[model samples]
Target: MQTSSNTRCCIVGGGPAGMMLGLLLARAGVAVTVLEKHGDFLRDFRGDTVHPSTLDILSELGLKKRFDALPQHRVTGIEGLFADGIHALGDFRGLKPFPYMALVPQWDLLTLLADEAERYPNFTLRMRCEATELIRREDTGRVAGVITHTPEGPLHIGADLVIGCDGRHSRLRNAAGLRPRDLGSPMDVLWFRLPRHATDPDGTYGVPGRGTLLVLLNRTDYWQIACVIPKGGAAQLRERPIAEFQARIARRVDFLGDRVNSIASWDDIKLLEVRVDRLPQWHCPGLLLIGDAAHAMSPIGGVGINLAIQDAVAAANLLAPVLLAPGLPDEATLAAVQQRRLLPTKIIQAIQIFLQRRIIARVLAAHDDGKLVALPGAARFLLRFRLIRSIPARVFGVGFRREHIDSP
Candidate 1:
């Protein structure tokens, strides 16, 4: 038997965007229901970098102290190794107040948001509920609700507004007939964990050498490492023995020493196929798409999570009033949310594309020539200076058009 429920707003996907929007709307006294397919937020290797903009939002919500209490590692700045030496690239200290990036497990962050949102009587979270299709009004063809698959049976959720905060592979986006235009990316990442010792590096840093780009994230007891390989390269790379892969990593970042042995087999490594894309339009009638549903960012600056959270804030700020007061929000109201967030999404994706084509593609080309040039002199000079370093810091750590908690 199918069950039926109704709410003012039904948010599909309990990701950063969905959870944040749910919390803000609930705070505004809107009846909000968030559907999460997973029973818990325990996924590994998700985006964990909580940037300064997110920190500022947490403080605005009065959740700063609670967030500070979560277990996390602080990355004060970004550094890169060159043929010359390791150079400080981006310094977060310049971004006063929320000066550092906090590397908290995404699960912890989601739990915190969910717990707080649950405190509001108007909010409800349904776990292990998967939205299968959009329920549209027969007369107007406007989206009216979602048909979800739950453990018990199918359930129908009727809502005045349906906001899709689902991720890159969002079913809601597809169900709404909204397609994201693929911008393109040249690399995929292989992620794995290696034991961290007292002798290991204290902070996260990047080693860009030869044709390889390796990043080591300091995770206290273990180092979460990312190995960036050319797009569709993982299959070819894995054709060789796992030992060869380990050797390649050791050759790139020698500090790992013998610890690369932790990768006993290919099973230990996870491949992340990266893509960059965004929808031409983010809404239609009663449905609105935000977060990765609206735009998927490349993993260059670890800004995906930051962008997703910002989208939620902007959506809540723009839609909460209309959602509470009127008949259903018009298409124009939903369009306003996209208009507010589209620029930042486009700008960040543009920067990522520039780096991918100009820097990464050129460096990877050295795989054929067997020669890799160091960073450009002018670029190095800008990153070397303390004052100029903040430029990259602000770009990555704080981001553009950072949103504030404007709902309540």
Candidate 2:
């Protein structure tokens, strides 16, 4: 790779947001370098749902074909079940060309983006490289680049603009002295995988009484289930036998008892505590924050990845002019990106919180009830109504401003 002493942009954290932003900026002819601390994308059970709205962005980028070719499941809608066995389903077909959410593992999606990024000569990916601190200009106190730990040693890469695409526990945000508002009450998720059964060949797995079962309805033949558990309670559950876990699950939803032939160890499960937080200001001078670094959303609607993609798109759209014509990234340009993105990001975060609190929490609490009346009716209503069905679609793809498709 060629070294550019005057790199135009430096993106920290090579997850979905950073990778997507790198690809977008590189395609726009900006010299961009992405720094990723991790060596590879091998982590299991992450946010994998690609909403229709994100698909629209991929289509615009001419990368949807590659995404569709991956081994994934096409989820037409989401269904909820009450403890009493009542179910509610939300159908997404009423939206646009692609109404369903595509269920692919997060690693696979990252690989696709990284591959596409390789095609752009201006894009550089530095894996196993950790960004240690931001480099601010002494005179103006504006961010100029980053101090990173490379294989060789500490290296300072100077750029016209710096972006933080790091995850929830963002070191850049903290180092910048930006105060983020926390939305309180984090929920934990226990993720586990089950082997495919002969009767479950079609890959559909869920019942009114059981927790959410995500079927990877492709050649993988693995199902990912996210069961809500008490925060910090995973260790206690790990002490129990595998059969006890299965029995507890069966008591809530009887279908799993008949379908599951054997019990597995607790090691198969992974836990995550979901929380939402957003910075009051997304930009300061030449510095900017994107994705989870700027706004973290709950996993309820599976909108985290989509929201990150949208943020990348919006940032690219707003920053292209400044990067192409300017001597430096001015405060006005930085503010433009935040002005265009903050409201939409807040709205999406709000929706995620509502779903997690009002809908998901209620469903999980009712999982042990004998009367199964709530699940079915809710499914029917969500599937039938225009207002309810549009919420997910809009969150997935639509933004604050409606622009003509012809505009750049």
What lDDT tens digits, residue by residue, belong to model 1 across residues 106-127?
9999999999999999999999
| Least well predicted 10-residue stretch by lDDT in candidate 2 | 210-219
Estimate the overall C-alpha local distance difference test score of candidate 2: 0.72
lDDT of 2 at 38: 84
Off by over 4 Å in 1: 368-378
Q: What is the lDDT of residue 124 in candidate 1?
A: 99
Report the error of model 1 at residue 21, Å. 0.5
> Clash pairs of candidate 1?
none
Residue 378, model 1: lDDT of 88
Residue lDDT tens for model 2, 44-122: 8767878787787778888899999988888775554455433324556676878777888888989999999889898
lDDT of 1 at 282: 94
User: Which ten residues in a row are the worst by lDDT in model 1?
Assistant: 364-373
